[model samples]
Target chain A: MKCPQEFVFAANYLADMARSRSLEFFRGEIGAEVKADTSLVTIADRSVETMMRDAIREWFPDHGIVGEEFPVHNPDAEYQWVLDPIDGTYRFAAGHPQFGTLIALARHRKPILGVIDIPAMDERWSGAHGWPTVHIRQGRRSEVRTRSCTAVKDATVFFCSGIMWRNDPMAVWNGMHGVNRLLDGDSYSYGLLSSGFADVIVDSGMKPWDFMPIVPIIEGAGGRVTDWQGMPLTLDSGIEVVALGDPALLDDVLRRVSAA
Target chain B: MKCPQEFVFAANYLADMARSRSLEFFRGEIGAEVKADTSLVTIADRSVETMMRDAIREWFPDHGIVGEEFPVHNPDAEYQWVLDPIDGTYRFAAGHPQFGTLIALARHRKPILGVIDIPAMDERWSGAHGWPTVHIRQGRRSEVRTRSCTAVKDATVFFCSGIMWRNDPMAVWNGMHGVNRLLDGDSYSYGLLSSGFADVIVDSGMKPWDFMPIVPIIEGAGGRVTDWQGMPLTLDSGIEVVALGDPALLDDVLRRVSAA
Candidate 1:
């Protein structure tokens, strides 16, 4: 499906914000701040998210927006913009280049446009439902696809946070095995899967804003994404979901884990 | 606890070679090459390893060396150089800066020195036994420490690869679910933990060269490195291992997962 012009415009604007802010202090280090939740949040995160939100308000008057920072705005709307601001906040704070900015357009409950922009690493990946996912790194853009790894033994499976599994060890463990490798974090793993470097990503304890944008990118790149029970994931699907290179393997993983 | 001049000389020599070769390629975009094992390796990887091996031979005569690109010479030796050439080949080939070159000095199966030279990321972490592990990022060297996050929920655990869990879904599920969080790749995770950003790192698969260098670095930074069973992870230790900020929590996690 073609992404609406507004969505594309918003994504580009957000990408530019992410890139500019990332370059501003990327080589220069910054101190980290501990949030009320006790997790760390860098100043760049607040700055980046705020910039994106302001641009959104000017561009789309009626569109709802959900972001990691600030209050949730119009969560019940049919058309919404989800922003991670800076998905890899900790990495960014530590001066690692794995961090990025994530923006997505959701119509009703499903993601129709997704953009993952890693400024420090100089990579960008975006896609809309029915359109091929695209990966741009170091100034090159190409269509991306998932690797054809039918079994866990041949595939790489990742969970963004160990706590996601700790939060539900039984489900995480029961569902995955034979995976070729495991990675942590979200946008980057999804990007790797989209670009055929990995095969699966599963985790629990995520928000809608965290998982939504990733869906179209993964699915558009020839992958399947769902909850642990093999159900399609909507924005309301909670934080637990699995994205895999092959639908059949995804089912097998879900079946085994759910049964256990 | 100071690094001997000769050792430093060798490390810098290797680092120079690594940086020169890797920097040239890092300037331009490069694609991934699937190794014989179907694992990802890049052209920069081959170039870096070749340069390092050459430097080792030139700088330190009669010192046997082991690297990713070549077989070990005098595996059972008084002094042997162990090298990964590029530790995160997958990340490097994928254009992720989290990858780096790993070099360690082993004398009779015990690591006496270790260094992680991340040229593309512009950082280096190194330590020898009894010396405090120091982080050298962008030409600045600072001593590193592990954060004292005692509570399980308060801690950030690095679960290196979910694929390990997929291999033994039952075991990994039980093991990982007990941790607070899982980060990707033990090498980088251990580096983070050593520098106080993360608290624990657990992994099921590791080679001696992959893990040995990390041990001194972690222990030197006031942390514990052991088999998942809480046993010290000497070269002879099992592949499964855990590094923790606090011994009590480490024990609790190990017991919980082992029981599961």
Candidate 2:
């Protein structure tokens, strides 16, 4: 399904608004509170999501909204917007610039457009169905694509926090041996993969608002996003996610992780 | 021991030159090759070191020069400059902006001045003996001090990489439980600790060029830098290093890691 350019434009505008709102509270004294799920939430997260929600409502009254910091709205609508106003809240609260705003437009539960905006770094990546993934950094824009890697052993893999995989830490730890692995890129890891700099990313304990926005960006960049069992990610997909810059290494990676 | 203002000025000048040289190859087609020790090295690393070394030789010919990409120069001199032309080479080669240039001036084997320059991020952090640590970002300069976190369990810790701790991975991993731990910040992690954003850092397999530069920066910021055994880091300290924003937490952290 091709995503209409109008939806893509709207997503970018929403992301721009989110970036502005989030930056206002960045590096300041934020009153961060622990959410019910044990995750951190700051005023920036709530403010950005609220701002984006208002704009989405004003522009597309019937469209649904699913956000990290807010309850779902218009859940039965045919078009839905998924937002994670601030993806890496811990990093943001710690004054790291890698945290980003994630935006995705889903049609009938399928994400057709996605945006990853890193405001502090002045970098933004956007992708839509049937359109090339584009990255804009410091006012320069360029199309991006994933590179090809045929084997798991040769892949440069990124895994978000080992503690996130508490249920099966050793499985990932043992499986990722012999591969060039780096820990903790969070959402930015997917952006690196989409730009052909990282080969694979294995992350767990992600929510819909966290994983939905990257699906189109990775797919449009010629990569693959799936569960550890090699199933496509959807609005209701499980938390254990694996992304591959080169789709050919999926089976090898799956086998390695499962056998561990 | 007070660091001479001239040495600090020279260190910053070297860091500035290194940053410019490294940025030229960043995100470009870098021909990265594996060193004999299995670490990756690129033209940017060698080029930056060469530029810095040349400047150092011309300005202070009697001073010793030790760099990651080259052999020691004037090793017997009282004033020695330690340089890691490009720290976090893996991230740099992957087009990630977290890589940085580290420069430190040591007198009688004690690091008296240090600088961490992240070219892509346009951020620089510098410190000297008896001087407050300062951070410069996009031309804004401010003195930085480490925040107070007195307990190991409550500390925000940054570890370099798990694979580097192949000797005792479980010791560090099990010890870090219940803390806000992040993996892979390299030299930038110490900068964050100095800026009061991070509280602790545990790393292993560090060379002199990697660890020497951070000692003064952390010390000047009201933090402590030492080996895992709590001994002060010297020119010949062991590869295992630990940094704490609050000196009060050292015993707790050492006990935790040792007990693990």
Candidate 3:
């Protein structure tokens, strides 16, 4: 499935809208209200989600929505927008500037456009189905592609967070125990993967909004983002997402992290 | 022993000099020459270290020097300077902007003044005996303090990188394997701890220049920094370091990471 150029344009527009709203809360005293899951929610999250949802309603009323805050709107529409207004709220509430606003357009449950906008960092990574992935930082833009490194020992692997790893029932913690070059990071790690700086990224317990935008970015950058079983990511995909800059290392990475 | 106020002033001044020199290389195509230890070395590292050493020679000709890139100067002097021109060269070479220049003043083999200067981020953390720790970013400065959080479950722990945990002969990492709210970061993590935004930073295989500057900053902020064995950090301390915001958690934290 392919997204129209206008879809990518609209997704970035919606992302910019989210960016302006989220920027005001970064490094400031933004209060957080604990959500039902014991995760965090700040005004920036609610405000950005509401603003994006309204924009989608006005521009693409026929499209459905899946977001981290609030509800699912128009669940049966053929095209849908997936959003995670603040991707790393735990860090955001602590005034750390790595949190981001993610936007993606999916057709029939498959993402065709994705945008990861980090307002504080002034960086954005966006991709559409048939075009090269683009990374923008500090007003400069360049096409990006993942590198090809096959050996697991030479590969720099990353986990999403120590918090997620600590509670791993999937035993990924044990699976990755001895990987010498591993790192622990977040959406930023996925950004690095798409840009050839980092070779592999793995994480679990993510939502459709948490993992969808990254699918197009990495895939268009000539990498892979799949579940533990190597299935393509969709709204219905499992919580675990593994991204590799070098497609050749999938078997080696999978052999280690897929089973524990 | 207390260092004269001039020593702290000179340290920050030296850091600024190093910062101005290093800023030009950040995110640019700085050349790297691998060291015999298989770690990275960049022109930024050599240039900044040379500049700092020259400045120290001009200002305190009798002081000793120990730097990452060059040999000791004035080794028999009563006071010495420790410098790590670029502490995170691997990230710097990858165009990741978390690298920084560290400056510390040691008198009688103990650090009395320390500064961590992150040029690209435009952030700096500095501390001297008899004063509060300071964090500077975006042209604003604030006296920072570490918060007290006693329970391991309630604490927010951070690691310098997952790479350190991947090859843990000391096993402090296994002790921290399952605590909640862990962040993957570096010197920035220590700055956050000094600012009361985080607690509990653990890393091993550090050098004098790599770990010394952080000692005064955290201790001046009313926290603690020591080797994993719970010994106060000194020129002779082991490479493993554990920092905690609340002294109450020391026993609990030490029980796990302090031993193999």
**What TM-scores do the predictions have?**
0.75, 0.93, 0.85
Off by over 4 Å in 2: A29-40, A162-164, A167-170, B30-40, B162-164, B167-170
Give candidate 3's error at residue A100 in angstroms.
Answer: 1.7
TM-score of candidate 1 versus the correct structure, residues matched by position: 0.75
Q: What tens-digit string does per-residue lDDT give for candidate 3 at A116-176?
A: 9988788999998997899998889999988777776666667665324344422665566
Q: lDDT (CA) for every model shown?
A: 0.69, 0.82, 0.78
Of 2 and 3, the candidate ahead on DockQ is 2
lDDT (C-alpha) at residue B182 in model 1: 37
Q: State the fnat of model 2.
A: 0.38
lDDT of 1 by residue, B124-161 (tens): 77877767788976678799876676666666666666
CAPRI quality level assigned to candidate 2 from its DockQ score = acceptable
Which candidate ranks first by DockQ, i.e. highest? 2
The DockQ ranking, best first, is 2, 3, 1
Chain B superposition TM-score per model:
0.85, 0.93, 0.90
DockQ of 3: 0.28
Candidate 1 backbone clash number: 22
